[model samples]
Target: MRDAIKQLAESRSECTTRQTWYSALFSYNYPNSSETLRTVLDLLITARNEKTTQLQDTGLDPAVRARLQDEVSPLIHAHLPDPIVSEKGAIGIKAESVYQFYECDAGRAAVVFVSEILTAVTTELTHTGSIGYPLTTVLASAVGVHSRFLQASKKQVLDDLPI
Candidate 1:
């Protein structure tokens, strides 16, 4: 169980292996399944909230953060448009969605955005041995990506959830 949880955090681990681990958690038919699953879920939720707060408190101005997030929406929308119902009735994205996300225009933009950021970081590191790349340059690249999305038809945002 410990190893399985560790696998979830390893980027290079095979998706099938991760899926198997998730399945095991759900398939455990022991009397303690309910308590165990609840504990695991609470831990996951707490960790997520902490990370989100960290990101939200980053020194970037709120406007800059919002602009960057808007640029990233396309990739997120493509990747998570579908829901997967798991063995224990948990809803989530399939690991395979990672591959599918890179196939569309938004995904392509994400690739370019990532490449721009990586290039900026690498160049900065090679020249100064520091990660103090300028925020303006990153935001500029994001704006360029956002312009491309603007030319595409906008997706309607639903104001209300279906009952």
Candidate 2:
């Protein structure tokens, strides 16, 4: 978890998406609001604990790990005007939806991605003096990665829950 967090933050420093504008999932605000950051940290910690315990209890096989890396980690998207779910945005993903999704394999993978983002943000802040990195810079990273993970399972996770 520590290594993943550090590596994620380092990778974002080179994010090309900064050339264009973007925001975190369910948020229009740049960087992240304190409340939102808090929420992200909470989610990250929970995911860390969960995944850690999971691996400890049931070590992953090489094939299973490879499958997760291939199917669950990559960002796949439909090219066009964009998916209907994305055409219309929301203030944030419903917590209930995330909770339900947490029980599934895809959901767990998504959680790992989101956790990476929060971990990166936290790491950057640690070196930003007192004020920390600009919110814009924080959110400016390539939008499609972590957000994709969160969005990938949105319909299945959220189900009939309102956006």
Candidate 3:
């Protein structure tokens, strides 16, 4: 019947839309290249240091402190990509570009933590909506948060390291 055919077409269209949305969300969530992660990490480190210094200064008001903390917290949290290890026990996230800084256990832990966060973020985004604009916006927000968290974490690790 025409009604049945129409229903099938509609379902197919919905399915396609969902797929597209899912793909976009995942792509944004997982940086295709380690370079992307590295870039984000660098920015995060800078932000973390700046925020920490601001916090330490005596003149900052409570509102300013709150804002700075909010801005820096997410970047510190998002740097959690685990290193990809080879069969020979060589550990690295990418071979050439976006080299991971895993000289110590703290760095390795940061990567693992961020990776877990990414997975959780993707799942949360998928469940809250049907891969639509609202979902995309939410994912974008999460990406920003993760970026900040990763930066802060990196700074902490670097600070702990002996020069």
Candidate 4:
């Protein structure tokens, strides 16, 4: 399941590029296909349901679970493209706040902040210095990767924008 989630994340990253390319094709082709749009919406709904179910089964602490869910839910809501197909073949995937969360310095900062908090909590819970140091290092590395991801996304958005 973890692998599946990781793959999904990776696929989503690649799909962003495909989306840009397809937007141009879509604008020229079938610009109004409610049926096709509906299929995408249905798939999103199914994915969300599965994720929710997985979260429920994880048995994480209620507070932690709530916080994670709260943080992720808005991103899901914001990023889920409206089924409306534009003339430019844009699927109306407008979620500037959510996009910014994955594309800006502030967003990277938030990830680092959360990672540090988690590291501290883990350190306190286990009282095992060995584990804490490695976890901290991993979290720090994640912050760097996330920052790079955001930078690339920002560049892509800028490239796609109309002058």
Candidate 5:
């Protein structure tokens, strides 16, 4: 039992561990990371399912699959309301606060601000300790990947419809 719990905590060699992530997010006791990490896990499982179902034609190689699972496929929340997908008010507020706090509006110095955020988030969320490890990883990179996946899933479902 102890070994299993330890493995579970530190597993997901690709993604960051829950203990580290949760502690970074709030603290070891905060519950939000439970959902966040599980969501990431579920997304990975769904990506595997995609290979068997909608994305079979693409035939991703092992490297691509590992990259997608480990780096690019985690969902992200946009600072502005993402009405097209789903509305997460709390995340939206948090994102907005981050953007303003860092002054993403600070055009010339935006690089520093963005870099700081990317470093913090990546350190906490990815096992690689670097952005998109193997390629070019960033906090927002997963959003692009997952958005495309959602779009592909929609297309696949529509194609199956008789209409």
Candidate 6:
């Protein structure tokens, strides 16, 4: 029993093990895991980097250019709301002082901004692919890769578990 507990503890430290447990316990996986979020973000980043680099090339193809312009650029450049500093009274007086709320968690702010952009992309893809057909294709492929990674992770966790 002690050995079993120790083994379980050791396995829990593995990321795949934790992902499986999170999926089982929460009935959802990505939202609850920063690692999973990072995985998705990594896909976005890689696509952005590769395409942006290609865009910089002087001999870019017209079709690729259209795709990048219509699809990728808009998503990357999606506007997010500026942090509110304070609320003012009708008489133009400061209603109350605002703390350094926006300044406190810059990382969280970035994550929230990214999450909103991802949400917009997903929503647009689901509805009309209005972003662009090319972007939709790229997004679909990225999602396929991410799904495979998660499936492999879960399988690895199961394989590693004690019999």
lDDT of 3: 0.42
Which lDDT tens digits does candidate 2 get at residues 1-163? Answer: 2233323433433455624211233222222222333344345545544544554435688776565444322121110001111112212222322312121232243354354356445445544544535753455344445556655444342323211
Estimate the Cα RMSD of every predicted model relative to the unseen true structure. 18.0, 15.5, 18.7, 16.4, 19.3, 22.6
* TM per candidate: 0.26, 0.25, 0.32, 0.27, 0.18, 0.30
**Candidate 5 local lDDT, 50-111, one digit each (tens):** 64453344777777666554432332222111111111100101222221111111122223
Candidate 3 least-lDDT 10 residues: 20-29
lDDT values, one for every candidate: 0.35, 0.35, 0.42, 0.38, 0.31, 0.34
Backbone clashes for every candidate come to 0, 1, 21, 0, 2, 0
**Model 4 poorest 10 in a row by lDDT:** 19-28
> Tens digits of per-residue lDDT for model 1 on 18-115?
22222211122221222343344345445544444555766978886676554333222222222222223222222342211111233233333343
- Model 3 has how many clashing residue pairs? 21
Q: Which candidate is the best by lDDT?
A: 3
Better of 3 and 5 by TM-score: 3
Q: Ten-residue segment with the worst summed lDDT in candidate 6?
A: 85-94
Clashing pairs in 5: 131-137, 132-137
**RMSD of model 6 against the true structure:** 22.6
Ranking by TM-score: 3, 6, 4, 1, 2, 5
Best-matching candidate per TM-score:
3
Candidate 4's error at 102, in angstroms? 31
